[model samples]
Structures are given as structure tokens and as C-alpha cells.
Target: MATSPTPALPLPADRPLLGIAFMLAAGLLFTLLDTGVKWLTQSYSPVQIVWARYTGHMLVLGAYLLMLGWPRCRAIMTSVESLPGQFLRGLLLLGASTFAFLAFRELPLLQVYVINFSTPLLVTLLAIPLLKERVTLARGLAVATGFVGVIIAIGPVDWRAQPAALLPFGMAFCFSLYQLATRRFGRNDHPLASLFYAGLAGALASSIIVPFFWSPIAMGDIPLFLVVGTLGAASQLGLIMAMRCAPASLVSPFLYLQIVWATISGYLVFGDVPLIETYLGAVLIVGAGIYLATRRG
Candidate 1:
């Protein structure tokens, strides 16, 4: 009876956990970015908000290129076999960002998140036709279950009454397309190069359209515009680092934690609470996603 207290168990030495931590942090940052989009949308059109975000992202990427010195910067900026894929990927992402911003303007954050979580499932399905990847029975079942989850999340869409509800789904599809394009370009281009083009495409495209909808920004709101860009770029960096540290399968599941951050932010900042059905749908979607992630190909 003289043995003092039982020794505490030692923590496991796991590098993947570090990747997961990074993924979680990235998720929180993404939620913050979305919150900024929602706030700024109150004052500006979705196009303006998107332009500000793309401008910030492009500036950050430009600064990164500058820090890399002339040779490396030129290397990343130079076109290669993947240039077309990179441009397409960038345009796809621009569409995704525009749709997401539009969705945030109308729906609550949690609702948008729940609907947007279908991107992974969409990617899995698209891989069959676009990438010629075979889906096993289990993965197929998971995809089917994911669709059911989406229907549940959407809770009956009426085109005339709730058209904005479709924006998140469109965002998911555009992002899936971007990911597919990435799969092709990933084999040829350096990751940073592809990233640079994405920023460039968005900035260039939005810069052209943003002028039509632009209104002078109030001095008070300038900081928010800056936050929108800075936070968006930072979140993407965190995601890239997380994926670099661990396999996509290991790091990807942690992205579900984003809904938690969005839920909290929506409640605190906007005083918006999701209906119980939304939570039910999110559980289904996340459960299916976990199945797909952990399933052996």
C-alpha cells in the first residue's frame, strides 16, 4: 500500500496527431474567414468581397515569391505542361469562392457548412468518371449515404422559395472540379506553382468583374477587408502544411471540426442557431466522410 499514486500514462509519440492539430487550426481559421465574408457581405456585394479576398491572397503570394528570390520566383511562375490545368484549377476555385461568398450572405454559417461538407463525397464520385478510379462497394455505399445526408441537411429545396440554398452545393461541386484538376496538375507542376496560378486566376478574373459592382469602402471597414484576405491565405497555408505533414486520409478527417468553429462563431457573432435537423444531417455527412476516409481502396 506504500506505492504512491499510479504513474500517469505517457503520451504516444505520434506525428500524425501534429498534422491533425494543424488541420484543426486550419479549420478554425477557415471558419473565421467565412465569418469575415459574412460580415463584409452585409456592406459589400459578393463580387466585391471576393475581389478583396483574391487581392489579398494574390498580394501574399506575390510577397512569398519575392522572398524566394528571382530564380525561384521565376521557376514557380514559369508555365509548363500543367499550365492549362493550373489555369482551369484557378478558375474553378474562383467560381467556388464566389458561390461560397454568395451562400454565406444568405444562409447561416452552420447551414452552409453542413451543405458544403458534401465536397469530399462529390470528389469521390467524380473520380470514377474523371480520374478513372474504381469505387469499392463500401465506398459506393458511403457516397450514397452522403447524398442522403445532403438531402437531410437541405431539408427540401424549393427552387423559387430557397434558391440561395443551392449556392453551397454549387460551391461544393466547383471545389470538387478544382480538386480533380489538381490531381492532374499535381503530377506535373510544383505545388506552390499551382497555388500561385490559383491566386492569379482569381485576382485577375475578379479584378475585371469587381469594378462593375464596386462601392467605395468606408475607412472603418478597410481593416475587415484586410482581415478577409489575410485570414483566407493563412488558412490555405495551414491546410497545405497539414497535408504535407501527413497523408491526406489522415489529415482530411480533421476538417470536419470546421463546422464546430462555424457553429460557435455563428452563435456568438450573429446570434444564429441551427435547427436540430441540421445537426442530424451534419452527423450523417461526417459519419459517411469518416467511412470513406478510413476505407481501404
Candidate 2:
């Protein structure tokens, strides 16, 4: 049986709850992929892991498109001439992934994830200047609350603060830019086609880095690397389907699930249990995100 063709998306109203659930699921998969990348660092270089992820993501996505008669992939290549912002978004996304992969090597998985969740806060802050988006009082307060949670997640910044922890923060900031650019440029390009190119961009960028920073891949690490790629594709496709079903505001909050997913994965895989402050911070960030999402104007 053929899957029902997705109904055209209307603005901010249709099936909001369902879309949010889909986004939540996507976030869960994404963080699982993140955890796998984190684990691989014990035996593989971050660049190698990143390359593997791209390799897997491309193969999976390519296979999907091939199944669909190579719809979006063809369009992405033919239409690249007209899509500068998507290219820029891809470049920033690649940078963000690089930073994130490096951070995974340096920091605990839970800390890295919670810190990246601070992207929404950075998005709020950047909108005033980059997108000229008007800021509301609720969102301002929420951004503040979110940052407080981030600091809590980071623990006290001491002399022993790992220099590598900054990479995730940088990833958050750059990924926030990628989000903004997605909105700015997605007007002309289909989202999936744009994403295909973005994945290609990531793969190409890693080609250079994987040389100097490359390590020999162990057979043990291949499965996790495959998971990272396959799950990343699934998560992106899920997210795209979700946006078509419901408004972004409804689904956006679920991105925070990365923190939850990371927390659970860390506990099970690495014996890293959450501290009291971590839970407290999660509550504050979630509450603030809820407020910000629900606020009107």
C-alpha cells in the first residue's frame, strides 16, 4: 500500500500535537546518533566519525531518493545554481557538526547535549539583529532562564574547564545561524532537496579534514557509525514530515528532547548519572521553552 501523500502545509494550525510528537521522536533519534558519535571517539577520530556519519547519511538518503525515483537529489544538483542561502546554511551546519563531534570527544554526552539545547536561546538573541525579528518579553525571560540552565549543565567554570567544551557552545551558536538561514532561504528550494545538498556539503567539507585528522576505523566502531548516519537521515525526514503537518512553534519545543535522550543514553552506556542541578536545569529550560513557544507576539 502506498503511503498517503502529505497534505499541503498551512500556517501554524493543523494537527499541532501530532507534529510535535514527530519532532520529539526525531530529537530522540538525533541524540542517540550523537551518543554513538561520542562513544566512537574512544577508538576513532572525530573527523573520521564525522566522515562516517556523512557517508552513511548520504548512502541512506541516496537510497531513499533512489526508491523515490531520485526525486530530490536530482533537483538539488540541478538547482544548486539558484540556492546560495541553502549552501551557506549547509556550510554552517557542517561547521556546527564538526564542533559538535569535537565536543563529544572532550565533554560528557549529557553536558554536550544540554549545552547545544541552548540554541533556541541563541536563536532568540540573534533574531533581533540577524533576522530583524521582534523580541517579546516572554521570550526574553525564557532566553534568560534557558541560559541559566545551560550554565548549570556546564557546572562551575573552573580553571580545569576543558578547552574543548567551548566547541559545543560554538556549535550551538553556528547551528542557530543555520536555523535562521534555513528560514531565510527555504522560500525557493524544497526543504528535502536543500537538505540533500546540505548533507553533500558536510560530506565534502569533511573530505579535507578526514585526511589530517583521520584515524584507522575499527570494526567495532562501524555499527555505531552506521547508526549515526541512518538515524540522522530518519530524524531529518521525520522532522520535515512533521513541519508539513503542523506549525513550527508547536514542534520546536520538542528539540529539547536531545537533553533527555542524552541523559538516558549517558546513564545506560557510560554510567553517567544526572546530578540534581542537571534535572533542575532541565526543568527550567523546558518550562521557559514552553512559555516562549506559547507566547503570542
Candidate 3:
């Protein structure tokens, strides 16, 4: 009896794995963007760093618009007025970028990431009240778990304690607000248009404030500043593609893989060690985000 070698099992044809991989790659690049932004923060004002990032993103996005030909890019830029939800979303986006940059100046790269990553924790609760969804028992537990992580990350928040710890937390809240606003305008605008407007808003906002605290950017740091914007824009492009390929619930859980990239990059570049507490809190926050997004999905 010639037993035929067991037939090979077929790989799943679903693009879920591929989408996951794309998102993870985006996560890594985004972490790298953060690191570059944080490093530049050491030499320049936070406003300057933000200006570099926004300018880079605008330039990168503008290249895409140019590639689309003038007619299409004009169509996009002209059609922007129809998107109302972008106002608040733009405000929140500006806030997150501003605060996150300021926070980076004060905290280690990984620490800033740990805090900003908690936006979903705030979103889960905000979604219920704002979206008029039913808040189930499971979600309450997830939110509870998430805040506990926030407490852990904060350690004891005394007035005497470091103010830097609060920056990422504020960054998280502002970002959550931005996401909430996105849920409103997101239904109307094309993803590229929405992203373009975000870049425009950031550039406009930063342009005004950046002048106040401007230090002449040394020619040497120009590449890093440009890389921040380029990477940030590309990350958003990847997110749009990933979301289109798969539902967010499927993609959202993969976001936490950012922690791995951040930890590794932080160690290699900055020789930083994330405390066990930071890791623990990061897990809880990621767990909560997954629980809420999965439950709704």
C-alpha cells in the first residue's frame, strides 16, 4: 500500500494575515517616526519638530496629489468644503500632534508611546455615550481594566511628581477626541481627502505657532525632520489600505504590535529599557482596546 505522502494542507486564502502584516509594518514605521520626532525634539522646539513633521507629511501627500494629475487633485482640494466633521477632527489632530511632541521632549520615546497608545481606552466609553450604543457588562470590565493600567503607568500622580507623565495621557485623550470626530466626517470624505486635509490642517496650525519658538534648524537634522513627516503620512496611507482590506476589528487588535517595534527601536537607538510596569500597563491598555473593538465588531 503506497501511502501517498499526506496531502499538504492549504494556506487560508483570506487576506486577514496579509492585512495584519501590513498593519504591523505600519506600526513599526510609525514607531520609528515617533523616535525620530522625539530625537529631533532634543535639539529643536516641539513646535519646530511638529512643523518638520507636518511639512514632510504635506510634501509627501502633495506628491501623491500631483501624481493624480491637476484635475483630480483640484477635484480633491476643491471638494474638501463638504466635509464638516473635519473641523473638530482637525482640532483634535492638531492637539494630539502638539501634545505628543511636547510629551516626547519630556519623556523617553517608549514612555510617550505607552501613553499615547491608550486612546482606545477612552474611545470605548466615549463611543457608548456619543454613538448611543448600549454599554454592555463586558465593556465596563474592559474600561475598568484599562484605567487600572493608566494608574499603573502613572504610578502615584502627586503634584511633586514628574509632569512629563501627563503629556502622553493628554496625548491619548486628544487622539480619542480626534477619532470620535473622524467617526462623524469619516462617513463622507474619501480616505485620501481626509488625510490630505489633516496634513493641511497640521501645516496651517504649526506654521502659525512654530514661528514663535523657532530655532534655526541645523542643516544636519533636516533629513530626520523630513523623515518624520514622510513616515507619518505613509503610515496613514497603510492604515487606510489595511482598513479597506479588512474590517477594523480584525485590524485593530494588531495595533499593539507597535509596542514590540517601539521597545526594540528604543533599545537599539536610545539604549532604553521599558520598565516591567510599562509593559504590564501596555498589555492591559491593549487588551482593553481589543476587547471593546472586538465586542463592537
Model 3 vs. true fold: TM? 0.89
Q: What is the C-alpha RMSD of each candidate to the true structure, in Å?
A: 8.5, 4.6, 8.5
lDDT of 1 by residue, 1-297 (tens): 000000112123436877678778888888999999999998899999999988998888788879999998887678446677778888988899999999999999998888778877888899899989999988888889988988888786687988998899888888888777776774455556766788888899999999899999999999999998987677876776566556667777788887778889999999998888898888988888878776776
Candidate 1: lDDT of 178?
A: 79
- Candidate number achieving the greatest TM-score relative to the actual structure: 1
| Candidate 3 per-residue C-alpha lDDT over 11-44 given as tens digits, one digit per residue, 9 for 90 to 100 | 2343677767767777877788888877888888
TM-score of each: 0.91, 0.88, 0.89
Worst 10 residues of 3 by lDDT: 1-10
Question: Each candidate: what lDDT?
Answer: 0.79, 0.72, 0.73
**TM-score ranking from best candidate downward:** 1, 3, 2
Give the per-residue lDDT digits (tens) of candidate 2, residues 1-297. 000111223445588887877777778777778778888887778788888877777899888778766555576556643466667877887878888888888777877766766776787788799988898887788899888987776676663556786887888888888777766765445556765877887888888788988766678767777888888677776776677768666676667667667777888988887778777776776676666665765
